[model samples]
Target chain A: MEQGLSNALNVLIVGMATVFMILWLVVIIGNLIIRVTNKYWTDEDLKKSAPKSNHPSASKGAVAAIIAAVEIVTNGRGKVTKITKQ
Target chain B: MDIFSKLFEMTAFGIVTYKTVIMWAIAFLLLFLGIKKKYEPLLLVPIGFGVLLANFPGADMGIVAAENIELPDGHYKNLFEIAHDYGILNYLYYALIKTGFLPPIIFMGVGALTDFGPMLRNLKLAFFGAAAQIGIFSVLIVSMLLGFTINEAASLGIIGGADGPTAIYTTIILAPHLLGPIAIAAYSYMALVPVIIPLVANLLMTKKEFKINMKQMDKLYPPKHQIKNIKTVKIVFPIVLGTVVAIFVPSSVPLLGMLLFGNLVKEIGSSTSRLAEAANGPIMNTATIFLGLSVGATMTSEVFLSPKTLGIVVGGFIAFAISIAGGIVAVKVYNLFAKKKINPLVGATGLSAVPMASRVANEVALKHDSNNHILQYCMASNISGVIGSAVAAGVLISLIGG
Candidate 1:
């Protein structure tokens, strides 16, 4: 009985850990790639009218929600520092 | 031979001895619900077939009786023994079925089909979705009060999350013996979302209260970094949950783990597209078929004919309705606190109907005030519900199975 109980515990731990590890790698790498792409894609000055990169309501350096969420979680709450337009 | 004797023999052969026909009728009902009502046909099809197989006698009965196989050359060994000797998969069906692996893959398909875009626009919906899952606890408490074991209560309560995979995942870990009843009940309620949710939603809100106008949260397409954050969230979310679960219930880790892995595959950008395909295509599709049938295989008359199975069915409906009520109540609370007129109707979408529930909320909102576009808000809640229920399921399993 003790062995059975321990076996169940083992199954649970190993399974959940695998999921966690996989997610950590995927999310960390995926976010980095997205951040890099965003840096290149941003149009600092509305040089091309078509490049409506600057958010209509947000500040010049405002990130997307997905990015903002990641930054806030990883870099800490204060690190996010949303730069809303004055 | 007496004529009565012949009739009795036929009756024994067909009616009492072979209960497959009645079970098949139930399977047909599932088919009707899937095809006609369009209630989660992906799972219902497989689940219905499983019922047919499970009810049919002689499935595993012969094998159950035989401890070993005897060969003419004086060799006798168990199925597992032979499998070890021959390198074959022993009771592979049970491995996937009893362990609850396949259902979570079905969830991956569900996750892939989900679009969190609307959810991003109005993140407040997450709170509402989270609130709806409160039913898991309430039901858990009730089940425990009713003298069920801790694991049984937890497994029973997860049905309130309204996510079949989470319910199955939780059950497989906490109470493997109750898998048949719990799974059947959970899937049945999930498929009946259209009917069950409306019943609960109406009970909570009147026509006037249900159709409040909520402000449209501004659309901000996620920046690249934000997209990555979401992916990171997708990744960490599962792991954090798994870790927490491991420390607690531990039995449910496998179901949670596989589910998270599938989600991780989707978030990993390099393989995102392929991961998306696997979640939606062959792996998910095939698993649904096998999982449902294999689960059905467990529902033999001897086990299913009991009052406990009936309790699972009743408990499942109660759990689902309570969660729906929880969502409605949470929305009302949010409205009172935020003082921003938000539709209580949108909260029902937190039952994880994906776009369908959101669309239903949109339709309801349109009926009241055409200008109010609450469907998007509802969609955010819908996606959040997916995550909310999954985590809640894990927690419930830990508490109960521990």
Candidate 2:
């Protein structure tokens, strides 16, 4: 029983330390990956690669009106990507 | 009279005992919970049915321990002979589960189904997932003090992970005898995430803490950087993280490696969509069926009707409660120093129950203030809990099983 208790204590210390160490590394590396990717891969690049709508682009008046509505509704947090007729 | 005696001997009723009847009642309870309550039905139904089959008299359907199988020649029966004598369930239990093969395959499917976007967006919250794992190790010490062997204690402690595959995998390595009880405890508590999360949260958190609006906090203290190309980042993430984790804890590679591989296929889009679909669909479903049945088959009348099983049930519940409270406390501590406060519900969600724990936390937050939506933030910690638990399992396996 003494041996078992000691071993359990060892596991408790080693297990928690290892788990925290590994997961902390994951957080740091994850942040680094995000920063490096964002630095090299700009939003403009994403926009360029984005698939074009099969239908033609909406008229300037319709596009402006839709953008205005979205801006109001989302308080400038939303962006218009595609406009299609129902 | 002679013919009547012979016929009676042929019937199962002649051999059925009170133990067998008790096991059947237990099986029926599981089935009722699965079919009626709809609590993790996909797994519980098969497991319940398997338990019933295992306990049936005269069927010999229960999984037999290797040493228990002897032949007339005084030599142990080989795999073929064991299959011939026992049943297919025994064969599967030995081949798939004893070898620790199925759980990682199920994990691969889980990975394909996961989206790590929320976690990546809120990187700081991932620490709570690690904090929540305090329950697993804490339980290990308590179980040992309660007279369980170190191996058995490790198996019992993993229930705190709240991940069925991780628990089963650890049990298979450290203490195969405890697999049945450990698997049942893990899954049952996972299904009870809705009940358990709220219970723990209410005990640990205040109303104001629950009403902390994550959206307002985000606006006031915005993230320093934005993921401009999320697709590329998602694809690269699993690879980098997998490599780093494998280096630190090589024992985790089997489960974590396959998980990252599945996620990679899913994130790669059209090229590997077929692989992802196959992984999350047919492959995962088949593994769940076999896993549930084989695990349940291990729960024979002789094995499961022990005082130890009762300890596992109680210990597993305490593990869940402690893990939940750990997460909530971590968030509260973080709030003390940080200007941007996190709702304690986000911390309470640091369990590996996937969307269920996150959803429960979201509901609790919404109850306090309807507009305080924190599902995405909760997910950030919840997903990290999955990784944290898997890593913790690996550490236990390496330290004890090795």
Candidate 3:
């Protein structure tokens, strides 16, 4: 039982350390790759080609239009309580 | 002699055993779950039917025969003469599964289907994926204490990842005998994520926590400024990450290589769309069917009824639960330092069931507050769980696999 506990503790430390190390590296390198790509090859066409529906601007734009309609209907008296995307 | 006696001797009824009856009932239960409950129908239906075929009296549709010999490349070479060697499912199992060829191809399909944008957008959430894998090692210890050898323990531990293919891959390498239970447990828990995650999360988190809105992430980074060249980043990520991972753990290269290869095909656009279609469509479907059938057929009564099989089933659930908790705990730890609080529910999605885990997180979030949409954040951890599991499997293989 003691031996098993020892082994489990060893695995807990080493296994977790390795996993965090690998993922930490992934996070760093992943960010670095994006930064480098953004710096060196900012292709406007490719950037435009990327889908934009999930972006804040897209959601905000939809909200702005709704707010404009609401303000007109209420003669600028009503205020937007909340704006959230489903 | 008597004609009736002769006919009876040749019939399946004569050969049927109690074990066959039990296995058939089990198969029917799986079919019920797949059809009625809609629990992973894509896999369970085929697997359930395969179980029926395998348990049929006098059918000999088992994926393995007593006379089959394993070859160097993991193919089962039938040496019991051609007359007895022509089991169709056995051929499929040996040709595809026994050679260890199917899982990587499945990963390729998964790669083609996945979008890395969510993970890229929220890199911090990626660590939650790794954190969830604590269940793997934790389970490994428990399994070892229960008398499983290191290899068997490793195979069983991977169920924590919630990634079926990685679980299957690790099992095939470390403990082929436990493949049936391990695969069943992995996929079963994956299907039950909608039920399981909420159960675990509700226990760990308060209603306020579940309702904690992360829509503010949109304001924090503003999706437009997140990444301008997502295409280039997506294309570069797999290549660079795959190389780094392979250099660190060469045993993982096969699965990671095919995964990255498929992703490259997808990201390259129209020129490679045909290849991507093949990888994610017919080829992927074919692999899934064969994988399901072979894995199901491999679970004959003698192999399936063991005490260890039951242990694997129990251990797998524990592993999965622990992984979910691990991710949540990691988020709590991360919250100690960070200004913005991440919904710990997103951490629960660190398991690699992909969109299912993320969707469940979203649903649970909606239950507390309707407008909350953490699906995008959940996806970051969800996708990272795949890579984390694959790497964990590699590490286990290096440390314990024979």
Candidate 4:
């Protein structure tokens, strides 16, 4: 029983420490990977790879308001072209 | 009258004992839970049927140890002898489960299915997953005090990981005899995540804490680091993380390595999508069926009806409760120093039950304030819990499994 308890104690201390150490290493390395990759990797492929957005189009009221504001600011000189949601 | 007596001896009714009857009831209960309550029906149904098959009188369907097979030469049976004598269930149990093959394959499937986006977005929250593993070691000590051998206690303690594969894999290494009870405990508690998470959260957290809005905290203190190309990061993460973990705890490589490999294939897109699909679909499903049946076959009336099984049931529950509370407390401690307060529900989800734990935490958060959806944040810790528990299992196996 004494030997068993001692072994159990050893496992408790070492198991938790190792778990935390390895997982923390994962977190640190994971973050570093992100930073290094971002720094070196070009985003030229991003536009092509990016999925088409399925977001709903802006309402008529919102479009009218934007056009009205533009008309007011430019004193009827600005023309309304195509509008797309970012 | 003599012919009738001889015929009666050929039937199971002649040999059935109360133990067989009791095992039947237990099997029925598991089937009821799986079929009616829908508690992990995919696994429980097969396992329940396997249990019933093992307990059937005159069938000899239960898994038998090599040493247990009596021979005139007084030597253990080889695989051929066991296969020839004891049949298919025993053969599969020895070949698949005892060899420790299926759990990691299922983990590979789990990895292919996982999305590590939320965890990468909130890296600091991953620490809570490590903190939640306190339950495993703590239960190890307690089970020893309760008079279990160190190996048996380690197997029991792994049930706290709340991951069936991890528990079974560790048990196969540390104490194969305890595999049946440990697997059942792990899966049963996992199915009870909805009930268990709320129970632990309600006890440890305040209403104000429950209402802590994660989105509000994010708005107040915006994150600085952002992944410029998420696709590239996803593809690179499993490789880097797998290397680091394998270096530190080589024992974890078998399980974690396969997991990372599966994730890599999935992230690689069109080139490896077929591999990912095969892994997560057919390969994983096949492993699950064999794993479930073999594990259930180990639970014969003689193995499972022991007093030790009762201890496992009770100890498994305490381990689960402690793991949940450990996560919640870690979040509370983090809140004390940081400007951004996290809901304890996020911490409570630091178990390896996957989306279920995260969903439960999300519901608790929503109940307090309908707009407060912390599912993504909860997933940060939930996914980490999978890695954490697997690492913990590796540590235990390395330190004592020899």
The lDDT for every candidate, in the order shown, is 0.62, 0.88, 0.84, 0.88
Of the candidates numbered 2 and 3, which has the greater lDDT value? 2
Candidate 1 vs candidate 2: the lDDT winner is: 2
Off by over 4 Å in 3: A1-9, A45-86, B65-86, B217-225
Q: List the residue pairs that clash in candidate 3.
A: none
Per-residue lDDT tens digits for candidate 1, residues B26-49, read 778877877887777877777676
Report the TM-score of candidate 3, chain B only: 0.94
DockQ metric for all predictions: 0.06, 0.36, 0.24, 0.29
Which rank order by lDDT, best down to worst? 2, 4, 3, 1
DockQ of 2: 0.36
Instruction: Residues B1-402, candidate 4: write the lDDT tens digits.
Output: 999988899888888999999998988988899999999888888788888888998899898754566567986666787788898888888888987899899999999999988998998889889889989999999998898888888899988888999999999999888888788888899999999999999999999999999999999998878888777888999998998888889998878888889899988865677789899999999999998888888889999999999999999999999999999999999999999899989999888999999999999889999999999999999999999999988998998896
Greater-DockQ candidate between 2 and 4: 2
Q: Is the docking of candidate 1 incorrect, acceptable, medium or high quality?
A: incorrect
> TM-score of chain B, per candidate?
0.79, 0.97, 0.94, 0.97
By DockQ, rank the candidates, best first. Answer: 2, 4, 3, 1
Total backbone collisions, model 2: 0
Model 2, span A1-86: residue lDDT tens = 77778878888888888877887897898889988888898667865744344357655566657766776577556777766668
Identify the candidate with maximal DockQ.
Answer: 2
Candidate 4 chain B lDDT trough over 10 residues, lowest sum: B63-72
Give native contacts recovered, as a fraction, per prediction: 0.03, 0.76, 0.56, 0.69
